[model samples]
Target: MLSPVSTDSNHHPLNGTDATEHSVGADLPRAIATLNEEETYRALLTATHWATLDHAYGSAAEAPKRLAELLAQDQTVRTKALDYLHYTLHHQNTLYEATAPAALYVAAILPNPRTTRTVDKGHNSFPGCMRAELLLWIASVADAVTDEADVLSRRHGFPLDDYPPAVSIRRIRPQLYSAAVAYVDDTDRPTAEAAITACIRLLDDPRLLHHRAALVPGIRQILGTSEQWQHRERAIDALDTWGEDSTGLEGQQNPFLFCDSDTPTDNGSRPIDTNEGYSEPPPF
Candidate 1:
């Protein structure tokens, strides 16, 4: 099969030898020839499709449009493209990683996270080839970017209090966190807090259990805090919802959820039933 022609390689310009190597291109004959083969064609096209999106090329919008056209007709291409997107978003190389500037386009064209999960399940070939990896990739990047912004806020002396309260933080927070987290494949202790927060959100929908296991430390910390008895129990309840075996701490079998979700009753053991009684959980 014909592989991706490096748009970065020198093309024999009609004028002469000194033309700068770049991503500008006409569709290569090799890519065209493979289109009839379905799977191979989809993989090849999706892998190289970003070439057309390069600003170094003349038509910026046209590349993604052509990609959408290919996606509409071929399920394989769409699956491959989405996975490719996750790869690009997470990879650390500045030349390849998705940039913050692309947020507008990402929001417009990317598949919804919830819907993307279903599409991921549709692509599996076997057990080890599970679909959760890509979704985790997305979540990772979103978390990373969010963390970076927090660092920036602290480093530059921007007060967290200055952030507008009415703004929907979750909507903006995930994309930032996702960008940063995408590059992290192995879980780290620092990010456990963010990962746990993400896992809880996913818990309302049970299917996330399989995927959430990797983030167990953060969840355990959330469940084990000692702020108050009731708050601690709620954390336990959340863990219980996931079931006893759901706890995956490194040393502990029945991991304790922390006191972050504290109740404000006299003993902190009682549920804070009234809005007046309970302090709100921090902005997720």
Candidate 2:
């Protein structure tokens, strides 16, 4: 589940490093359409010493290259890059020092028209856009730092805030949310649902509760028609936790299809469908 929505919906704990901004009167979102995508790719590489950080396999030296590869003209090259992000940087829903930093770049690239036209692998029909892959990959990272993640970290020795990577991940919520929220109304049905899922997960930080007010109707719209039952249920759970009225927003019954039940996962879950989450099959 998500972090319990702060009891005081208005209680934004902007303490030391946890300070989230109360600056916006109305939420404004960002998209790649508004950005220079080439500059974004370059900045991700130069933004940090990626090798200095760690991912599942070891030094995150490959993080920058893989992220750059996401934009390659060859579809296979791009899909492989996304696969690397899934299995390594945010491997099995575990966060690495590189995961959060790399995630910021991931957030920066949404609404790229190229990915929006691509279908993910394994689905023969109307599969989601490649942006869904990026959204859910970010979802995996955000899920790793929820209050639930806190339990795991405490078991190992530290609370999430004290963990360097978790703290970094928490600090970037607004940026990630910006990327997701802008897509909630996407024309692609699955893409809209994926965006809704991303927003709910990111709002676990009390500072983002304010966004709930604006998202309710759009969420209801997506879930209303969503066949992705697991993701749909989790989104409803998040709404209820935040004290929103989920009156008719219940999910589809269980015995869901393999991909439907296996997708929209959380906190270490690699939904069987998740492997198919990133790329559409190539045409002969």
Candidate 3:
């Protein structure tokens, strides 16, 4: 099989969760007021023919079921199903035919906190709600369609277009950006950071350029403190691209700050980490 262009290597996570740490990020319920979470999820699911979509593997027919499991009453089921979706939707940052719609589903379900039971799902040591990880995955998908990535994909004979199992995921930038921007003010810092990263790349849609400045403050915030270098780096690039001054911002906080060994750390006392670097997982 021919390898296509890997546009953005900016954001990602994994398929497994460390059993020891289970930290939750900001309260999602507060972000969403009075919305019927269950009804909303069902409505979104009913409109899509998931069986006709495609992922890194095969048909996305199983996607709807896996996504519905996000609301499962069982913790193990929720986390495991989340992991499965991540693995299938974005294997190694190579977006598949099914990636876009699946991503839309993830974005659609953001308002519900009942689906957030996993932690340490991102490549960073950041402890957050499962929503944060989902946002980060969106970022990774958008990252795969950046200008540089497009050049590489073309050179590699993949062309990053709305074609087969190769590059169809590149054309839906505007829609994805629209869905992701809804959480830019999320109470969860990681989630907000992930959403910001996603919106920055998806802004490739010329129509969204005017909104770039609005996202600056969040980008600055990410650069100021995020443990994930990939997120921080993207923020810096975005600032430069948009002509925003990113003066004193650094690439990463001291991962060693108040830590022992090289294992890295998480939200204050938690010490939660996936031990993965900036690259990704089978689902990046």
Candidate 4:
């Protein structure tokens, strides 16, 4: 589902000077290792923000190669690389690798939940702060989408700021569609239905108003169910925003037993399991 960003894969749109020089290349591994010490880690995090804002493309291009180099000598460096790569992806929207031939393969090599470990430092640390901010952004956007484009914009329910800006919502729209389709097919009807319901909620996110074409078709799946009441209301709100159907009744009981409110209301319901586009308990 990830689309090619630019027609020209042979050329980079913009280039920056590579400041980190490895003269011998042979001594690069040892040098990078030495650079990863505590002070360097803090510097890296500080550098991350500036790189994200000003030089995202360069950082995204550089992080993976540096990661592979560091991973070869000491696996722990993978942690640092992953953190930086995540930052690049969230900010720059650059591909994992610059070359067309290596894009898919490199992307697949990304560590998922299985391989990637969360970097936590007590209650407050740079990475920790980043994670919290990223989560908040995701929650905000997810609560704002209005249709398929919004869902696409939100990157299949993942928050926009948590990933590199180089990877656009449009690029991954097909994957999001496939994921939703798969969610509907799973044997557990209620769970599958609930996920579809969540998709409706995602589209209702206010941030996605401009992308109505991508969101309207999925509305039929979310209509008239107490189970998905809140999502239904949001969907209705989105529909209203688009001048489709914007009316709401007070004290309506949602079939899914969800609370009715524009703001997020966590009722402590069962967790949604959305892997492989099917219904199953989360891998808790």
Instruction: Tell me the whole-model lDDT of each prediction, alpha carbons only.
Output: 0.33, 0.64, 0.58, 0.32
For model 2, the run of ten residues with the poorest summed lDDT: 4-13
The CA lDDT at 220 in model 2 is 71
Candidate 1 regions exceeding 4 Å error are 1-63, 66-73, 87-90, 93-134, 146-171, 174-248, 251-284
As for model 4, its CA RMSD to the true structure in angstroms is 14.9
Regions more than 4 Å wrong, model 3: 1-40, 120-127, 162-171, 252-284
| Winning model by TM-score | 2
* Candidate 3 residue lDDT tens string, 197-271: 777777765656777777788789753457756556666777888788988777656645453322322211122
Candidate 3 lDDT trough over 10 residues, lowest sum: 1-10
What's the lDDT for residue 281 in model 2?
A: 29
lDDT of 2 by residue, 180-222 (tens): 7877877777667777777877877768877787877776767
* Ranked candidates (TM-score, high to low): 2, 3, 4, 1
Give each model a TM-score.
0.29, 0.76, 0.70, 0.30
Best-performing candidate as measured by lDDT: 2
RMSD of each: 19.6, 7.8, 11.5, 14.9
What is the model-wide C-alpha lDDT for candidate 4? 0.32
> Tens digit of lDDT per residue, candidate 1, span 1-284?
11111122133111123323312212222223433444543443343334333222232333443334323435455555443333232222111112222221232222222222323222122211112333333344333324344567668886433433102222233332332233223233222322333334433322233544544444466434533343345445556656644343333233474422222222111122234433232122
